[model samples]
Target: MSEKDQRIQTGKFGEDAACDYLIEADYKIVERNWRCRSGEIDIIADDAGRLVFIEVRTRKTGGRFGTAAESVDRRKQQQVRDTAQVYLRSIGCSAESIRFDVIAITMSRQMDSILEYKHYEGAF
Candidate 1:
């Protein structure tokens, strides 16, 4: 596969792993790949009545760019925040609590299998 295709596959794998992890942890997934004018939120979940906006980052271990978690920089955080605002307005429902979370996954480059995973709650 091409590099782009590989990257896309890696991303999907990470998101899938994140979802499974959330489910196992008893988080109800509300949406995936939620998109609006601002940008896309990788996942939206309900965590004990609180609304959570999640960003999933995936990369192979030891990538030159950076670790998966480090990838979610200030600019990306702002985008997620902006999109979350729009999402809230669109829903028109008052949330008891709202938060931003990030799920970072690292895979074995050769194995294409998850090697490490981290979930940051209230990341922003």
Candidate 2:
């Protein structure tokens, strides 16, 4: 596969792994790849009755770019907020108890082992 294809495949696998990790951690997944004109949310879940919007970032290595969470900059945060608004409107969910989360997955050199997964709740 091409480099881009490999990256995409790795991303999908990472997201799936993140979802599984969330489920195991007691989060109820509500949506995956929820998109709007503004942007996209990788995962939507319920955490103890609160609405949780998750942004999953997967990286082959973190040394060069710093870390996966570093990728979600101001512009990306705005897009996530906009998409969350759309999601709230569609599901009639109140923004009061809603939270934004970031799931950063780092892979090892072999690309087969997960080096780390950092979950930052109430990120935005």
The C-alpha TM-scores of every prediction are: 0.95, 0.93
TM-score of 1: 0.95
lDDT of candidate 1 over 9-84, digit per residue (tens): 8888889999999999999999999999889999999999999999999988879999999999999999999998
Local lDDT at 11 for model 2? 81
Q: Give model 1 RMSD, 1 decimal.
A: 1.2
- Per-residue lDDT, model 1, residue 6, is 87
Summarize candidate 2's per-residue lDDT along 1-124 as a digit string, tens digits: 8989988887898899999999999999999999888888999999999989999999887457678889989999989999999999998877999999999999986688998999999898
Question: What TM-score quantifies how close candidate 2 is to the native fold?
Answer: 0.93
Model 2 off-target regions past 4 Å? none
How far in Å is the alpha carbon of 12 misplaced in model 2? 0.9
Evaluated at residue 36, the lDDT of candidate 2 is 83
